[model samples]
Target: MVRQTLTKHPWWKIGVIYQIYPRSFQDSDADGVGDLAGIEARLDYLANFGIDAIWLSPIYPSPMADFGYDVADYCDIDPMFGDLDAFDRLLDGVHSRGLKLLLDFVPNHSSDQHPWFIESRSSRESPKRDWYIWRDPLPGGGPPNNWISDFGGSSWQWDAATGQYYLHAFLKEQPDLNWRNPDLREAMMAVLRFWFDRGVDGFRIDVLWHIVKDVAFRNNPINPMWTPNVTERDRLIQRYSTDQPEAHEITAEFRALADSYGDRVLVGEICLPNDRLACWYGTEDHPQVHLPFNFQLMETAWDAVTLRKTISDYEASLPSFGWPNWVIGSHDAPRIAAKIGEAQARIAAMLLLTLRGTPTLYQGDEIGIGEVQIPPNRVRDPQDLRQPDLGIGRDRSRTPIPWNSSAQAGFSTVEPWLPLNEDWRERNVAAQDQDDNSILSLYRSLLALRRSHNALSIGDLTLVDAADDVLAYRRQRANEILLIALNLSDEPRPLLLPENTCIAKVLCSTKPIRPISSTLDPNEGLVLELKEKS
Candidate 1:
């Protein structure tokens, strides 16, 4: 068994968090697109599963260029998702179920169609022209810098009318804001205050580390192992465009706004690897984001040692200011069930919840949903069509949720915005609702177990032993001690237990297990409660 420990904090103790990608979650009107009302109507199901909060991916008004990530209006709801009243209802519904709601805040960029950007681009002398990053072309008619967009091609989009190239790290339609401009920063803060004043619980900031760019607009060096077709931005080292020092300052401002409300939180999405990722939490003088979404579980290789090392390294690297978090699935990545196979998805979920940090669950993962195989002819994402060799087919993971066996998978009267998976008839919420052994049921039980025991909620993570494919750990807080063990292979493995302790099998993804007499079968996982001798 490998041992680890965590500092006890309020937000870090959250039991279970559910991520809702608005477009594919549900459709309230037969329009075949999900709206805020759709989520409100489904609140009971989420609450029933014992989820503590729901992270709603960007729902702000957008042109649908990059779904809702390209914000046209930071304060208003998009017609595709619904109006203000619908979101108000959503908050009421979520709160009624004892759950909190988190909105996606895209602070790094705004849609070119946004009012501020439109005015900025209309003329050089416009008041809002400073809102975006615009620079003149080099002498040879090339871009001023060699920054590459995350979606491929040059990060600069040349504007013929102004004879300048505007910086856009993602899409040309979404212009990167000039964080060096204090006016723009103040405006973004006002937007956050506006939402908070309206009672928003918190925000899950999008690409929070990409807020500031290298001041000199210098060219990024070519990566030694750079390959054009593999990653979206692998051609360059991205030294000048991401994870700038000003990012921490911006995050501190965001955290302060959210901290105004005692229970509010801010979760940042920093995609960099773990070594430098922990710095986003800020230093002792200021607190950065509440929970920086750690993607180690999603990025780690599917091996016992790799996963164990990732978790252990994160625990060791966490700064004294902010809490640690773990995410196995999200909107932009493939489903966890598909990544590790259906049998192992439950085990992954078990480990995520039983571990030391806050756990985030992507929507539709509870019932063993995998990434759908979308054919090239039916591909919808521009990224997939634009760069076929990249194999960044996200539509496979963004398919509409399978609520029931009904036509359209109970998602809409018309065809969904994205195609529903063909296997939805058999693998859906309706079918799993009645089966205790189903993944959804297992998730519900896991949430209940985590909440009922303080040890599981906010306890220290101490690895007892780790050998081959078997790993064991203890979660302790005061008198409660919870030992979690996993048999990560097909063959049976013997696990060493704590001496003079009575083992009580509290939860397991497979068959009911006892500590000594019962052996964990292949892909079997367990959470055992321990009682010390008098």
Candidate 2:
């Protein structure tokens, strides 16, 4: 019997999202890797943080080539992470706390170990031969195109047995799917339904923009000035390879599928500028995604001026069909705590929770966990495997979470899958939970304040004049207006206040904001409320 699942609508407005990288988050089996049970046991901790949902990274059947990104099976949880029953139990627990479960959907490619890819590469006339992109060798015997992999080297890999080149935008072992094929589209949707039926809330579509490519096999133009940081693939403009016009339609299809399930949401990882980023939201009549993960704040230099400009730019560029969101840290980049320092991580958390959008807090960022220092011999990321000199491994941010001050920081009974940070004694969750002034406590207070005030969550944002090292903005809902000011520099700084509004009270401050204070100390930021002058 075919079970029809309906779409879930307006799912983003309810609460804060906490991202969990399951493999590094916890390990119940003490196998050195985190599993679903580990996360299940920690639900109470997350629920206490005022998080409305959990966005778990891929736990699907995989060879761990990309740490679950290269999925071998979309419908089943990997044995390393536990079975389907464990995932079901985790979902049940999350729901019991009124929390939603968002899973990572690697729509761009599949591990070569996947049955579809294995069958696709078996023979030229195999039944599933066209499931993945395959091309004949160029007239001169090299790859058919000049496209390069994001991980490094040519994007096309030749299968000696098949005498054809296959497309892999990432690691060679992960082949790009042929999304241009309708059969493949239906099959992928079936994977989505498999989870939807399992009571999952939604998905964080990984590398969503790379899902489709130009079918013409055209060569991409070369960049005029290729920075060393730019990948060999990024040397080209990516004109034909990404941001395809058809992507919007595909997103709409996904939106429609998610809509088939009541209140399910779609959040896409769109790496683009504000203007281009807003386009993924679909046309006014039909919305592509509830929120396209906004990384502008994460990439921008941490400064009042830069942050103010980014906020204004993103707000101005938001499409009518979509909502705005802000992400300061994620598993792929440097930790925010490391990026801005411990004091600044607290300030950033304050700013994140108080902002007017759904906020996503990366797993370890709450406790101010900085990036771990991994030596050359221990790097596990594919990016580092390809370019060691660049110091680009994301595993620095993927270090195991410090649950408590125990052997292996209470994450595992034995040595962890990755080296434990030597400083876990000071950074463990137990230490922070007991300290009233800790980052974890600050996050709790900030989230609670935001949840208590609708003006902070869904209100309209208005920028105010703030001097260098100071950022000031107002969030307004109906007649209630809340003004927030942050001093982003060391030592004290003065900010220009809006006219006609008397200072009602200081909503939040890293340190006490002195009356008529002109400067905020290093790492200090504050939220102020304005009173209507009688």
TM-score of each: 0.96, 0.96
Q: Per-prediction RMSD in angstroms?
A: 3.2, 4.0
lDDT of each candidate versus the true structure: 0.83, 0.85
lDDT of 2 by residue, 225-338 (tens): 889865666788887888898888989989988988988988899898888889888887777987889988789998888888888888889865567788888889899988
Tens digit of lDDT per residue, candidate 1, span 64-139? 7888888999999998888998888888888887788888999999999999999998888889888999999998
Task: Report residue 373 deviation for candidate 2 (angstroms).
Answer: 0.8
Model 2: weakest 10-residue lDDT segment is 1-10
Residue ranges of candidate 2 with Cα displaced over 4 Å: 1-11, 512-519
